[model samples]
Target: MVNHNTQLLSESETTISYANRGLNYGDAVFETLRVSAGKVLFWEDHYFRLMASMRIMRMEIPMTYTPEFLEAEILKTVEAEGQKNKTYRIKLLVWREEGGKYTPTAKDVSFCITTEILENPFYTISGDFYEVELFKDHYVTAGLLSTLKSNNRIINVLGSIYAQENDYANCLLLNDKRQVVEALNGNIFLVNGYKIKTPPLSDGCLNGILRKQIIKILGQVPDYILEEASVSPFELQKADEIFITNTIVGIQPISKYRKKEYGNTVAKELLQKLNVKARLG
Candidate 1:
């Protein structure tokens, strides 16, 4: 097996402590980044979201953890593994330093960068659609925390397990009100001709970076309008098409939900737009 270590500096190595708040109490925020040719995709957006999450959790952002600084660290970690020329997914973890499980002595934060190899630098729309089902094991609570991707992710963990056990490619999560929130790992979008509907941050959906990008791209189209609203499973089942978006996969089309089948008409166009935008940058 290959050895992978969490890097703190270019030449230094460190390991998480037994008292780390992130380990014991899930007190951390992380960004799953895509790296192609040594450059991070949507770096500024990811950096700002990480900062926002830290502030929301009352953890001080280290002055040295600026976007440019962190980007260099990510590249260093990738190059260390001799994978700088290849595509991969890197996780940037920012956590509160050693502290009591429930209460902390200080708000200081620390970070680590880890990488995983990916097969492709750009998303390739799969010819077959994703299989999905509803996950009712838990309902996400709508609040400030719901909008951030924190370490407390037992809900998604369990949802993923359910999907695998049932042989599903993905599962939909619902908020407490029984409204569709998102997929196990990505944001959900429903297409109906010229309109698109997705759960809003107010509906307990994470403010995913790709979700923002998709909405921005759709807004630029004169004939399309993307609306963030509360969605129900019934509405999802009735949509003309359904797709999920995440950093790794720009757009994943859903083929079947229950007895209804969906087509990829809109997903194809959006995927093209996303790829073009990514390449132009």
Candidate 2:
């Protein structure tokens, strides 16, 4: 089931127009949310981020779109799918109304909510070996627009194909300046000793929800120092640990990058704290 502009419909009945702007021009912004026990984890952050992304894309914010209203709609869709009591992954997509080429015919927007069940209710570290390689074929332009979760992801799509062809679990994307921006799917963090480094939003990494949570968690701890700085490719070989973060995975520790292998000491510690925060919320 899916919610199209607050109207619940089965997958077969939910029909998007042939000329839908989102499908035609990639003019859309979306938020991926994790819900557990019928509550959205980090709801406030996700809501604000969605609003911000819509604003950045110049999409009109409907008068009816409010924190409470959107949250209710999301939960309604989840319940309709019979996932009200189960852990689920929900995607809320907002797109401009059909009609336009490069310029939109109207600023008015439409939204859809969809859900899928997740295997775990809380975040857990995977014991499987995960490896990544650099995708140097393209570069993410460093700017504010790159930080938005809009539907401009050709680089990510290409990088995923490259990773698969090369037998790597994932690929690290670089900005025009040759600095490691992030992994294809999420934000990247490098841990060296007690210091942790993640690229700032200015470096073109997605303003990830889990990245913010991890930063807040690290700030409260006296042992580790967190830095919102650029990550160089050279640092990858020297880092003691590397972890990728997103709404779905929470924290995925990268096991290998070429011949260099990483440990999950910090990643494990942070995941425990993250789960605690999620439960408390």
Candidate with top TM-score is: 2
**Highest lDDT model number:** 2
For model 1, how does the per-residue alpha-carbon lDDT over 134-169 read when each residue is reduced to its tens digit?
Answer: 999899998789889898899999999999999898
Q: Tell me each candidate's TM-score.
A: 0.94, 0.98
lDDT (CA) per prediction = 0.85, 0.94
Colliding residue pairs in candidate 2:
none
In angstroms, how far off is 68's CA in candidate 1?
1.2
lDDT of 1: 0.85
Q: Tens digits of per-residue lDDT for model 2 on 1-281?
A: 79999899999897878988888988999999999999999999999999999988888899899999999999998888764789999999999998778888887899999998999999999899999999999999999999999888999999999999989999999999999999999999999998999999998899999999999999999999999999999999999999999999999999999999999999999999999999998
The true-structure Cα RMSD of candidate 2 reads 0.8
What's the number of clashes in each of the models? 0, 0
